[model samples]
Each structure stands twice: as C-alpha cells, then as structure tokens.
Target: MSGQRSDTECRGTHEWVSAAPFRSHLADLVGTTGLPWRAVALYADVPTRCVRSLLFGRRGRVVRRIPARVAERLLRVRAAQLNGLTARSGDAWAAHDLASRLAGRGQSAAEIALLARATRDEAALWLVGPPGWVSARSVLLLQAACHAAGMDWAGPADPWEPSPAEAAA
Candidate 1:
C-alpha cells in the first residue's frame, strides 16, 4: 500500500472482480429501477472520471471500492428487475443485503449496522447527487466496515491469510 500513486488510482490492486462486468450489471440495474444515473453513481461511490469512462468512452483508472452492502443491493435489484418483482421502487429495500454479505464475509450485524448508518449519513452529507457522491460513500463505507469488522487493527495475515485449500494449492 506504499507507493507513488495518483489520487485517481484505485485503492486495491488485486482484481477480485472485473470492472466491465460489474459496470454493465449496474447499468442494467439503474435502467430497471429507474434510479437516476447520478443517484446510482452516487450510491456506488464511483468517481466522476471513472463514471464518465464507464458510461462514455473516456479512459481512466478503475475505481472499485463498492460496499458489500451496495453490491448486494444492486444484485437484489437486478434480480428483482429480471424476475419482475415489485415493479420498481428503490426504497423497497433498506440495504440489508450489504449487511448480510458482510456477515457472510465474517462481519457482524452490529458492525454492518454501524457501517450502514455512517454510510447513509455520509451519503446524505454529500447531497446524494454530487459528482463525488460515489467516491465519498465508498470511502466511508469501506472505512467504517473495516473498522467495525476489526480488520483495521488485525494483523495482515489475519485479514488476508490464505485458506487451507489455497495454501495447499
């Protein structure tokens, strides 16, 4: 994590997920939910430059700090849209998908709630439609989630240690 990097550089270098697939999936979700591009972009914490690159053809660094909760919400929304569930209301879900996913990833409910609350508050502070909305939300969610999950103070191996099978591999 120590190196000369541009402000626009992505925080993590490992490609756990591909950006193109995620962006396309998100576009479909926005279309189905009637979520304004600004709102979706805001909630996802995507940078203006990155969003422009995604929606348009501009080139930029890939910024992918999507909250586990937001990602879960997007997945649920996409699934509902595909299944024709509820006919499209953004507020039908209260963002528990992120919490659930965090728990599955070894986070606790208390931690998830704390992170969600902080993220919602931060998003509200950013006006929820500003250009930096997504980036701000992403930063807050990650920071809060990491803190709540105790990952911030854990040893490196404790957080990223390979599973037994992976070690065997």
Candidate 2:
C-alpha cells in the first residue's frame, strides 16, 4: 500500500499530460522556496506522495505521465505562494499548546481545527502528542485567533519558561 496510488490519483477522468513540464515546475518550486515536496503538497492540498512521485518517481520507476489535475495544480504553484509555510511544521509545539489552552476554555478539537484551518484529526494529534509536523498555516490561524482573544504565543508558555529562582538554584 505504500507504493500504491489512490483511486483519485489513478482514476483521474481528465486527460493525462506529459509529466515533463509539471516536473520542471515542481523542481523549480522546491528549489526556489527550499521547501520539500510535502510542504508544496500541503499548500496545494494534494497528497505528499503525489508531488514526490512526480518529482522523484516511485520504487525506481519514473512517472512519465501525470494526471491533468495534478499537472495543472503543480503548474500554477509559485514560490511566492509558499511564504510562511514550511515542510517540517516548525510551530507544532505552539499549536499543541494553543489547542490545549483552547480546549480548556471549552473549545473542542473540531472547533480548534476550524480556527486553524486544519482537520480535527490534526488538532487531536497535536493535543495528544508532544509535537510533530504541523503546518504553518495552522499556527498562523491559531495565532490570529489567540491575538483576537487577547492571548500571546511569543514563545513557550510560562510553565515551560525557566523561573529566576530556578535559574538561581
């Protein structure tokens, strides 16, 4: 299942196009932005493997043809569009803290996900785990909500901060 293409990826009703141009665009996008394929896919709202397969191929097999939707989507992608986004989801810890605070304030994970423009699963994962790859958009969205709610996300929360007495000790 790891190497398999999903039904949507394989069952595109649109005409398939030569993967060369899309491949070029993908390379350029990655190169210019220094963003990995996964980041670009997050911005594009497509599967990470879709970009990976087109850019690097799968299991030693090069993708000669690409689905029209994927091609068009990749073609329209620009490096400028990836601003504030990242591949590693650097703000996961912050997002996790925000979700926890919001949850404590009677906000559900689904509502928090909505505020972050992320899925509930993502919110739940952030809540349960320490920190993982969370998209920057989620952080930005949650940050905006926090700002509106008079909260700050300048850094790790107070509990995590080293106290002066602790430092002296």
Candidate 3:
C-alpha cells in the first residue's frame, strides 16, 4: 500500500485544509454564489475599484498578487456561507452528494477534471470534499456535469443549519 493515507480514511480528523483560490476564481465566485460585487467588496472590506479590476480585468489588467488581507476576507466570506459545527462543514456535505451521484453513474475524478476544467488534484479534492472553498466556476461546471449525466445534484436546498455543537453552545 502507498504510504500516504487517503482522504477518506482521514475524514473529520485533518487540519488546515487549504481553501486558497486564484484571484480570477474570486471573480467567478461572485457570479456562482449570486453575491453582488458591491456586497463582496463591502464584506471583504476591499475597495470596489480593486474588486472591479480583479474581476472584470478592466482599468488595464488583472492584479497578479491579491493583497493578503483581501484574500483572507474573501475566503472568510465564502467559508462563512458553508460554516457548520466545524470549520470545514458546509460544502463538504454537498460535495459528498456530488461524489455519490457521479459514482452511481460510473464516473471518475478524471471525468470531473474534464467536466470542471480543473486539474486532476483539484477534481480529486472535489470528490473527496473539504476543499478550501468551492469556486463559482466549479459550481457551474459541476452543475453542468450533473445535467449532462442526467443526474440531479443531490444537495439540500436550505441554508446551512447549525451543527450540534453550535446548537448546544
């Protein structure tokens, strides 16, 4: 057996799963999550000008390195949407459903790479869950995949409910 442990065997016991996204992904995220640009700017505490520039590629070109603070705020906002009992909660369950549906259809992570235009490792992460954050681009791609495969993306329609730990606190 490989020395490395699989994500499955180590579920619910890992730490600091990276949620970092590209600045371009941030732009796509606005559309996927249906959050307004102004709201993202306000919530992320980033200037509207920067948000526009990064997202629209307007006023010249895209910024290579997003400011750390801005990236942090962006991540925090996305993370909060999925916030659950644990830090990495919300999207993990949604991802579980996607994986199951895909599996039932005899699809593989390689297919996810093609469907989502994500790298192999990225596709694997989606299948396994606990991604840093799910990009809007990924959401669109995964939805498209579900449509093409004639499968409904099986996820709850409601907002994330509080975890038991949270409810008890």
Once superposed on the true structure, which residue ranges of model 2 sit more than 4 Å away at CA?
A: 1-12, 84-94, 97-169
* TM-score, cand. 2 vs. native: 0.48
- lDDT by residue (40-135, candidate 1, tens digit) is 544443332333445554345454443332334344434353324223333212233334446557755455444544444433433323322233
Model 1 CA deviation exceeding 4 Å by range: 1-8, 11-16, 59-169
- Candidate 3 residues lying further than 4 Å off, grouped into runs, are 1-92, 153-169
lDDT of 1: 0.41
When summed lDDT is taken over every stretch of 10 residues in candidate 2, the lowest stretch is: 153-162
Q: Rate residue 33 of model 1 by lDDT.
A: 59
lDDT of each: 0.41, 0.67, 0.51
Total residue pair clashes for candidate 2: 0
